[model samples]
Target: MRSATSKARFPILLLTLLVSISAAAGEKLTALQLFQAKRYAEAQIAYEQLAAADPGNAETHFHLGLLALRRNATDTAIAELERAVALDGKNSDYFAQLGSAYGAAAQAAGLFSKAGLARKCRVALEKAVELDPDNLDAREGLVAFYRQAPAFVGGGIEKAYAEAEEIKNRDVLAGSLLLAQLATGEKKYDAAFATLDRVLADHPDAYLALYAYGRIAAESGLRLDVGERHLRRCLELPPPARAPAHAAVQWRLGLIAEKRPDLPAARAAYAAALELDPAFSPARDALARLPKP
Candidate 1:
């Protein structure tokens, strides 16, 4: 019943729609690529555009929230992360990131609001862990919360230790590092060092264990020479996904150098840290505070 002109018009409209869909997909891919490359500024703009075009796209909102967090935009990150969680409640990562955003907001909040924000963070992180027990990042956040929050807020040192044990049961390397961290926080430096030493003995090539040895020394101001040696060894190994970035190892080296009163070494180490990650604010701050030669 359709006229030839009408049929031709239908084909043209279909082709246009197909092309538009393809363009949208391509844009999303490019945005993701930028994000993976750590080009946060560009990724943020791209994600903003995508979110505007597809308001229901949870992934875009999630990445946008992460970008906001990188820039210390806590309120914006919370909003975007909340939107992502609302859109997809089943995503463990969304909950984990939302919990972190809440924790950041708590830090900046007045005393009266701090308890409430902290509670929100705990609840969100707990939910994330419940959703995905294997999510070590979520567990680590919960462990941190347990370590820092008062008993009145459902947190305690015992709880933190228990959570670390759970993490250790899953991934021995991550768990050992975490346990060492907790022990160090409690001023149990000997225990921390022993734990790391055992891991290194079992897996000599474990760069994370090496980094932890350096971190403990940096924090306790003990064994600076040994720590420097271990840290340098870390640099010789290829980093794993879960290990601290090279910048962090470099920062620790800077800390050791400072403790040694070797200003030049400290400056050079901090500079190297910044070279690895220009956005590493701690290195930048350390550099700024260093006395001018």
Candidate 2:
């Protein structure tokens, strides 16, 4: 009788173990799905629970970091991403995101702390690239940093160009866009337009190219009508992952409308931008600055 009872308990215990393992995996999937769906608040809670349950889980911390970053909680993002990197130093993505968080923190830091934070940001990004040379996001971050940072802080337009060339070698569209952006920054409007025109000719419906073209138009205040038309066309396209959000395109529309001196249209465009993303400070600020209706 005792032997029979022991055999019954062994099967029950094994089943319980399998169920627990399945539940843990399901939790991870559910949390990831929530994050991908942009249900960030819920995803944060779910990740926090997972972190609590499995404190060693680097993935959990990484997701939590990304969610915090989305909300502009840079401090929390840095902390969580740091944990992720500490747990998995070999992961290029973890280091890349940690670098981004560090960059954001540097931007918000006061003058005294800014340099140190920026250096950390650069180091992490460089490490990420070293770990995986094919990481476009990491390479893009390096390009942006090199383009924007002063020479003293390891920024150079030449370096930016080199990185853009590297990207172009891997992905023509992204590289062309980055190079065009670099040209735009230097007020080389013709060169910028020429590059973008080539992209548009090849991929007429590419939303990113359209948006980039519209952005240059808005920035230079040239070709307003064409820019507006292209931007409106961007709104009609399906937003793909990693592309500029609709809020950004709407903001550009507002800028173009303002350039046209169409006050009402500008106001409407800004309001539409805010409606899509209330946290979009540029749109919010622009809307607030308009004369009270």
Candidate 3:
């Protein structure tokens, strides 16, 4: 009788252990499935439950952080993501998410806020790259963060240019366009023109680049003839049928005409832009400022 009782108790203990392991695994699987499905709210709840049950589960905390981010709960996301990174110090993804959370918080704090928040975001993103240099998403996020930040706070034409160059191997045209934008921002008219020329040389029919070149030429006041030619070429490109390139080209033409004080031509171009895009505020504003003929 004693032996049989002991045997029964041993089986009960084994069964309890198995059940606990199964429950934990099941919760984790459910959390992953919900996350993959983009059911962020549900995933958050599931992850929170799992986190409570297994307080040391870094993956659970990471998922919760990501879910909070999806819901735009920036503060909560930051806390959870920071905790996730703390628990799993080697994960680049965790650090990248934390950086994104900091960036969102800084953006919410308004443009005039202190540089500390932006710097924190920058550091976090940099650390993410240090941990995983091939993280494309982190690289892109860093690029965007630096681009939007003020020049006084570690953001400038040089930084933008470097970031663009870093990604040029993957997308030459995009990198060249970005470089041109940085050059234009810095008032480096010659450099901007050169960058645009390189892009156009490789892809002659790139309507977007042509349009950008036209604007850069018109604004820089260095090469009106070249600017006008680019603008006209942009207009001559075959339409993509669903894009607003036509409206954009008309707007650019109006801008050139306005610069030349050709009121009649400016008015015509603005009218064409508005015809294509009724909600184009710039064209409407330009039309309002024009002298009545």
Candidate 4:
């Protein structure tokens, strides 16, 4: 009984509806299952299909964004996550994901010498926190993003330090560690030392803080002795932490020894690092670079 125009549109409408429903069901099941199983690539495909079928499905887009993030597709993740947030403005998780996507993009941009992209990352992260004040992950991401981003790109060391202090008052050691990293980035060597000292004063065996301190020292080029001490302490920590710490410390020590032309010590350090983490590429590379003894 429909007119010709209606008839033509009717089939298309019906087909669209059917496709949407099928895609939704398939995406809902496959995305969740695959995501939970850590099959992010497959999950991304399913989410993409659903997003294509129903562009208004914010959750599907969000999942696709997360999947892209897992695969290190920062640009794709940003586009998908931004779409997801636009479609569902009230979802805190969407904002958080969007922020993380921006942060990833910033990291990629830094590698390519695109400062603007890094600034955009900070804006996205700030918006995420504004949207979800209680989201610890979002806050942590913001702090980390800011710390890694250049000062000229809205990532001042002072700001990072203040944020860390705020987090510490709230009893978040992880955030405090990130703040210390910011201090290190700023070349506020004394400030960095004080921040880590405070943290270690309260929790001396905090392996994460110790590791961060070691990394800061190694990179800053101003505190080799202090860095070496922190790294050694990290190695003394317990269990899984000890393994990573040992690897990192040994690698750094190997570099120091290499600089000093102490080939034997460098070789020993590199070997020890590899023993702790056989897959540590940096240590392996260092070993390769060492002079034959």
Per-residue CA lDDT of model 4 for 109-221, tens digit only, reads 65565677767667766776677676666667667765666777887656666666666666657667766767666677778777787888888887777777767666666
**Highest lDDT model number:** 1
Kindly indicate the candidate among 1 and 4 with the higher TM-score. Answer: 1
How many Å off is the CA of 60 in candidate 2?
A: 0.9
TM-score each candidate.
0.80, 0.78, 0.66, 0.72
Best by TM-score: 1
Candidate 1 per-residue C-alpha lDDT over 12-106 given as tens digits, one digit per residue, 9 for 90 to 100: 99999999999999999999999999988899889999999999999999999999899999999999999999999999999999999999999
Worst 10 residues of 2 by lDDT: 284-293
lDDT of 1 at 150: 89
lDDT of 3 by residue, 1-293 (tens): 56988988998999999999998898899889988998877887888889888888888888888888888898899889889998999999999989998888898886556477788888889899899877766777777877778776677555666777876666776677777877788798899999888888989887767877888876766676677788888778876554447777788787788787688988999999899889988888988988899
Please state the error at residue 177 of candidate 3 in Å. Answer: 1.7
Give lDDT: candidate 4, residue 120: 68
Two-way TM-score contest, 3 vs 4, winner: 4
lDDT by residue for model 2 over 95-177, one digit each (tens)? 99999999999899999888888888889999999999999999999999899777877889999999998998999899999
Model 2: lDDT equals 0.92
